[model samples]
Target: MLILTLVIVQLPQILRQVQEWRYPRCYAAEVEGWAAAYDLDPLLIYSFIHTESSFDPEAESSVGARGLMQMTEETFYWIKSKIAPDEALNFDSLYDPDCSIRFGAYYLKLCLERYGGDIATAAAAYHSGWGTVDALLENGQYTRDGTILAEFPYTQMAHYVQKILERYQCYTELYGS
Candidate 1:
């Protein structure tokens, strides 16, 4: 049953590709440029977008995050001040894919650096707020390894990390690197 054997071997990869494509990148060029500019992985950005808004550019959280990256207005202003000091910014600008990713990617990069290059920690901070992550580290429940989580204190954040990693793995498997 050579055909059956082939099907069994290929089925998982095909499924993973389909799942990864379930949340396609809406702004590829913006993602590519910002990822490159920030030395971040494109798949990682894609994964965050999928988890944050599922490619919905107009998605807004109850807490007021908006756009493909679900950037908050406060964070948007911070980005404008920190990243592009001279640019005049407004809350509605977060709805723009190009603008949102540019700021979101930079923000993620900052978070990663804050955790000493830990994506999980940075992502945890993103989903659970930086203050919570800081408190977790201060309380000594979570590890600050920077590459892997020694222990994620929050259950919701742990689940968030797992989901993002799964999506990122799927994307990397389907797309090169």
Candidate 2:
């Protein structure tokens, strides 16, 4: 019991240390700009960034997602042509907070639009791909009432959606609205 109490007390300090060590420039201006461009809530973009990369500009996932937003190389290339046609895209720029946040916000907007702004559906599509989500919905695999029912396949992605939602709630409470 004593050890557990000590660990619980120290966990917040450890998390604070981690946050300070991993602090990347917020890039709020860039995030807001991209959010406006894509008609998304700036707070949602912020929450996504926090959840995806924990504000680590240089973060790279084992699957090769890169930068503050953990964007895939293919996604970066695709968005570069659409949103930054004249600018040459270098993979190294993925570590730039501004560039990464911009691309991520744009991608989230695209997903939101594709999924009709249903956060759960959009999140699931983002994690598991749109085709899978669409097929599940189209074939009545999911209920029309909009609960994340257990009948849905891709348990990993279902959990991912839950995590994102939980993180978003935390971000809202921490940052306000």
Candidate 3:
């Protein structure tokens, strides 16, 4: 009876530990360094990574997105031009956790800045593209204001945003001060 009572009392904490293990912060140094440099939340970037690749550095999507943050070749080159203009880096470098975290955090910062710090809209832009999010913003049915999304124009993108936000919340709760 005492063992059963103790187990019941410890259930919540045990479950939380399991969740924390599930969302492991695999590349902590890279994540922290890039996130700090970009002035973005580390947990938010972690959530983005979790949603994109589940922390698998070599993960790839059917659409050809690759690495931790799952950037397509086009997006990688665009970011590369801005951040590593002089480097002779290739698309395969996205598999390097350090490079991926830097570029991903930088892109997240750009998206956040573009959407006036609205995570939902920035996440939508990350999942789709800034152009698509901008067009959706122009439709009254999608956004109540010019900067924030009231309703995601596409169901798939909406779910992506939800997953990002949900993981962000979980990461914050587990590790935040």
TM-score for each candidate, following the candidate numbering: 0.84, 0.75, 0.95
Q: Candidate 1 residues 1-177, lDDT tens each?
A: 999999999999888777656857668999999999999999999999999888888899999999888988888887899888887668888888888888889999988888888777789887877887877777644655434356786788899988888888878877868
Please identify model 2 stretches exceeding 4 Å from their true place.
1-25, 143-152
Which ranges of candidate 1 are over 4 A from the true structure? 1-20, 144-149
Worst 10 residues of 1 by lDDT: 140-149
How do the residues 1-177 of candidate 3 rate in per-residue lDDT, one tens digit apiece? 999999999999999889989888889999999988999889999999999999999999999999999999999999999999999899999999998898889999999999999999999999999999999989888988888898886889989999999999999989992
Which structure among the candidates has the greatest TM-score?
A: 3
Better of 2 and 3 by lDDT: 3
**Which model is ahead, 1 or 2, in terms of lDDT?**
1
Residue 126 shift from truth in candidate 3, angstroms:
0.5
* Residue 73 displacement (Å), model 2: 1.3
Q: How close to the true structure is residue 12 of candidate 3, measured as C-alpha lDDT?
A: 98
Which order, best to worst by lDDT? 3, 1, 2
lDDT of the structure predicted as candidate 2: 0.75
- Model 3 TM-score, all chains together: 0.95
Worst 10 residues of 2 by lDDT: 143-152
